[model samples]
Target: MPRQRTGGFHPRPTVLVAVGTDKHRFDRLIGWLDDWYAGSAARPTMVIQYGHSRPPTIPGAVPFLGHGDLQRAMATATLVVCHGGPATILEARRHGHLPIVVPRDPAHAEHVDNHQQLFARRLGAARMVALCESQAALTAALDAGLAQPRSFTVTADADVQAARLAAVARVGHIVEDLVAAAKPRRASARH
Candidate 1:
C-alpha cells in the first residue's frame, strides 16, 4: 500500500509521476524519470504511480494508486510528471499543476495509437502542458520544471473570465434550443 501523507506536512519541491492506466506500458517515461532522479544532485521527494508500466527500483514507486490517493498526491506536488493521456492531463491541471507530459508512441507500443501525441501537441501549443518527446527532452524538462515550477491558475484577467462566461452562455443557449426542439407538440382539441 502507498503511504499516505496527512495534516499540513508535505515535502518541499515534491515531484509526482503518474504514468496513467493504459493497458499498454509506458516504461519509457518511468525509466527516464528514474534515470534523471538517479543522476540529479537535488532530487526532490518523488512519488510515482506506475500503473501498467514496469515499477521502478526507486523507493517511492507504487504499481498503482487509488483515485483519492492520486488526487492527494497531485494536490501536494510541486511538479507533476505524467503520460499524455487527456484525463491525466486534465486532472493535473485541476490540481493547478502544469505537468510535464510525455505522450506514448504507438510505434513503441506504448499506446493503441498516436492520439495522445496529437492531443499532447495541441495542449503543448496552448501552453497548457510541457511536452517532452524523448528521454533527453524529458531530462531537460524535468530539470527546468523542477528548478522553477509553475502552477496552472485560473485566469485572473477580467477579459478572459468574461470570454469564458460568454462561451458558457452560448453553450447553455444551444442546449436549451436542443431540448426545446426534442419536445413533442401537443395536438389541439376540436370542439
Candidate 2:
C-alpha cells in the first residue's frame, strides 16, 4: 500500500514499479529492483506490482493493483520503474513520469518476443523513456531518478499531451505490426 501525506507534511519519496499482467514472469526486473532497494542507504517508500513474477522481498510489494490504484500510485510516485509495455509506459507518461523502462527479453523468457525491446528503444531514441537494458543501467537510472526527481517529470501540460499522443500513435502502429506478424505464424501452424 502507498502512504499519503496530509497537511503538507511529506516524509519520504515514493517509487513505484509496475510489471504488466503478462503470464510470463519478469523476475529479472524484480530481482534487480529488490537488490537495489536492499543496498540503498536511504531507501524511499517503494511499491512493486510484481504481476506474474515472484513476490519481491520488499515490504510494499503486491502481486497486482487495480487500475485506479495503479493510477494513484503513478500520480503520487517520485520515480516510476516499469516493464516496457506500451500501456504502462503511456500511463506513466500520462502522469508526467519519464519512466525507467526495462523491456522484457525473449531470450530470458520474459516475454513473447523482442517487441518490447524494439518499442522501448524507439521511445528512448525519442527521449521519452530512460531505457535500461542491463542491471547497471537500471541502477544508474534509479540513482539518477532519486537524485533529481524533477528531471523525470514533464512539467508542462502541453508537452505532456504532445508526448502522450505521439506515444499512443507509435504504440498503435507497433501493436498492429505485431498482430500482422503473428498472423502468418498462426496460419502456418494451423496448416
Candidate 3:
C-alpha cells in the first residue's frame, strides 16, 4: 500500500534528508544543517536521515526520527533536500516537491564512484531542481525555498509517453529476435 502522508501545509518547512547509499553528501548535509540551525532561531528545523547508520548529532534540531518516520516526514516536508540518489529524487517528485539535490561524489570514495554527479548536474542544469555544493549555497537555497515553498508540478507528459513507447519497441525487438532464433538451422540451404 502507498504510504499515507502526515498531512496539511506545514507552516515551518522541513528538510527531508535521504542518503541511501552515499555517506559523503549525507554527512555534508547533516553538518550544514546543524550549523544553520545553531546560528538561526527564526524557524524550526527537522532532519530526517534515511541512512544505514545513526545520523550524527544535530543540536536542538527537531524530531530526529527513525526510518519508520521517513514517509510521513517526507509527505509533510515543504522542501526536500537529498543526496543524489535516483530513488530519493523520484520520491520527492512523487510527493510533488521540487528537491534540492546535492549529488554524492563518487571520486571521494563515496559509493563506488557511480553516476550521482552526472545525474545531479543534469537536473541542476535544467532548473528542474536546486543543486547545492557548499554550505553557503545550501543556506541560500534553504532560506529562499523556506521563504515560500513551492511544489513540483509536472508540466509535460512527453517523457511518460516516450518511456512507454520505448518499452513497446524493446518488446517488439525481443519478439523478432526470438522468432529468428527459434527457426531450425537450414540444412546447408541445399543437399
Clashes (backbone N, CA, C under 3 Å), per candidate, total 0, 0, 0
Q: How well is each residue in 116-144 modelled by candidate 3, as lDDT tens digits?
A: 66667777787756888778988877777
After superposition, which runs of candidate 3 have C-alpha atoms over 4 Å from their true positions?
1-9, 22-25, 50-54, 59-68, 151-191
TM-score-sorted candidate list, best first:
2, 1, 3
lDDT of 1 by residue, 13-47 (tens): 78889987767888888788879889987678889
The TM-score that candidate 2 achieves is 0.84
Q: State the TM-score for model 3.
A: 0.66
TM-score of 1: 0.74
- Answer with 2 or 3, whichever has the higher lDDT: 2
TM-scores across all candidates?
0.74, 0.84, 0.66
Q: Which stretches of candidate 1 lie over 4 Å from their true place?
A: 1-11, 151-191
Find the number of clashing residue pairs for candidate 2. Answer: 0
What is the lDDT of every predicted structure here?
A: 0.72, 0.83, 0.60
